[model samples]
Target: MPKSRSRHGAKPEVSPGRATLAAACASLVGIGLARFAYAPLLPAIIGAHWFAPSAAAYLGAANLVGYLAGALLTRPMASRLPAPALLRGFMLLASIAFFACSVPVSLVWFFVWRLLSGIAGGGLMVLAAPTVLPWIPQSRRGVASGVIFAGIGIGIAASGTIVPLLLQQNLALAWDGLGLLALVLTAVAWRGWPARSAPAPTLAARAKIPAHSPLPTTRLRALYVQYALNAAGLVPHMLFLVDYVARGLGQGLDSGAQYWVLFGLGAIIGPVLTGHLADRTGFGPALRLAFFIQAGAVILPALGTGTAGLILSSLVMGAFTPGIVPLVLGRVHELLAHHPSAQKQAWSTATTAFALLQAGGAYGLTYLLTATGGDYRLLFVIGACAFALGLGIDLVVGVSLSRRRFA
Candidate 1:
């Protein structure tokens, strides 16, 4: 970390915990509220006659498209503007988007706002942790990151628990309530961003840094594919799990939201648990295990939507949803442990791949749902198959690498 000082040339004290909390708030708005909230809200939108079921589903996909655009553009945008300013701006944008959604103006209007929120979320997701982690000590960074990322799960849990109560009044009130919650979070995080500029490095200090090594291109490419596949596998649950439970099972909105609540709870603990497992077993084994477990969870709904089955599926899938992020990143760092630059580049590539497939899968599944008259089971089955393929890639890579090591 670079030395930071005030304008008077005196060292400024920085609190890593406060900074991490601020970043977590940003993520809560970006992904937790912006993206995950839409799933539970989907059924309600359809029920209120705001849009046809198909249009509402497409609206959900619009956020994914914007996320891709935002993620791709954030690095370049940061080069021109300060990260703190950008983070603040994105949070504000997301809050505004939520307020704008309160009125169902038209499909195009709703889509544009949803897309903007997605952009805000994507930018925040990319920038938040990177901004805060540099200030944290190496030993505490893992726990700090888990707390920051847990904001997503927190948001999910909040929406599930809060949206229903808000909807008791009207759909507009529900939207307004969400916007107010986001605005409050944005206010809390307003001053949390650390100072951007660090003191310049001396020439001698710069010379001590080693050159980046060549990347493990083959393994990286495989990782990217598996990461992309994982996104495809997650789309069904992320977009339709609430709807599947509420309408598909004829259980009503309240019951479906209950399941989402469970998913959120799983998400809350997933990162901490998965990170611990990786520490003991290594990132490779942890990731392989994640794929296998997520595959079973995704496929469970297809085999049977019994109450116990749905409950188990929801918890497991929810846990793995955000839980898989750390595992993939740990794998990336492990693969490029010697090359910090390459690690950043590879992680960016993996994120892009995930976003691309996420958007594509959302649209494809929406179409499939329409064609099959809303066959929720088929979507779950397809999602499971995607995870299965990702598992296969990992197995193949593991075997091939083992052979190379032995040879």
Candidate 2:
């Protein structure tokens, strides 16, 4: 029997399976290798006199700014170029730019390279849903997005394990090696990715949504606010968690590193599990659960005085926080349907907002920490409040959406 028609009276068709999976995996590789590898390696790089403390922070901020620009540009670029070609180009640029970190250049040059890498990484993220979403059955989008995001966990784990060991022997060599690895992975991805036609119907159909569709506009705005707030809450932990463990809790470098590794481990598992749960329960409830878990996790350290408390807090926060990105994006996919143009707009807008929010979070933490005399406890308090606020907002949005459906 023929498949039932969609709301628009078009026969539903399943997208090709292998090709879609390959593309999604490639996107994961690109994001994992490019965006995440830096954090794991930053300590070693800073210790080696490669970047002064202020310079390193500036470079990180620059990367965030570049990401915002890239997210804003992704849709316009996709409109003109083939998605595959654009993906290949962005991957290559990011790979090369990251490898440039090994050259021991001036700090100015380092910031430039990092900024370019950030831009490329942003493009890859914004492009991922549009490039891969069409190939996924609507019913399976949550799982597919989870699977794709799981690559981030793998990438984080790989960097944590490999970079530290390499930097132990030689920092420059490790940076160079990481770059080479990214290049090879990009090549592998390019080879495996399927060819796509220009001006595809999926793309065109997505672009046709009326400007007044409450679904896309409201959902996109909600996601942006949620993500931004979440990112703000997370930045303190991402940047200062190690310092808190090492200085605040009196842990050694190795112990701090292990803590990060545990965090990465949780990150690896968080998305897949959250995605599965979202599929069964709905994104709204899943996100609320995640935020509450994160809120509790961040506050644990503040409540405790010993190593056990800190370690437990680290693991819990790590597990819940990073996974939120995929969950939020997956929800966008669910709300917008599988249309290409709408996907592009939704992703681009959300990502851009996310990037800006990340930047704001970083800067906000910086100022707050400096004002508080480098006291992270106060930051944790702020983060906990922010997470609770985000959870409340998400619940409200979910309830509002449900009421609209019945009305």
Best by lDDT, which number?
A: 1
Residue-by-residue lDDT tens digits, candidate 2, 141-211: 67767766666666666776777787778877787777777777777666544355323454456567654
Q: Give the TM-score of candidate 2.
A: 0.85
Candidate 1 residue lDDT tens string, 1-407: 84543322434245667788898899889998999999889999999999999999999999999988888888889889998999999999999999999999999999999999999988897788777765665445455667787888889889999999999899998888999999999999988888664333345545654565566788889999999999999998899999998999899999999999999998888876786677677788989999999999998888985999999998898888878877887788778766645655677678888888999999999999999998999999999899999999989987898899899
Which residues of candidate 1, in runs, are more than 4 Å off? 1-13, 197-212
Which runs of model 2 end up more than 4 angstroms from their true locations?
1-30, 197-216, 247-250, 338-341, 398-407
Give, for candidate 1, the lowest lDDT window spanning 10 residues: 4-13
Quote each prediction's TM-score.
0.92, 0.85
Query: At residue 245, what lDDT does model 1 achieve?
Result: 89
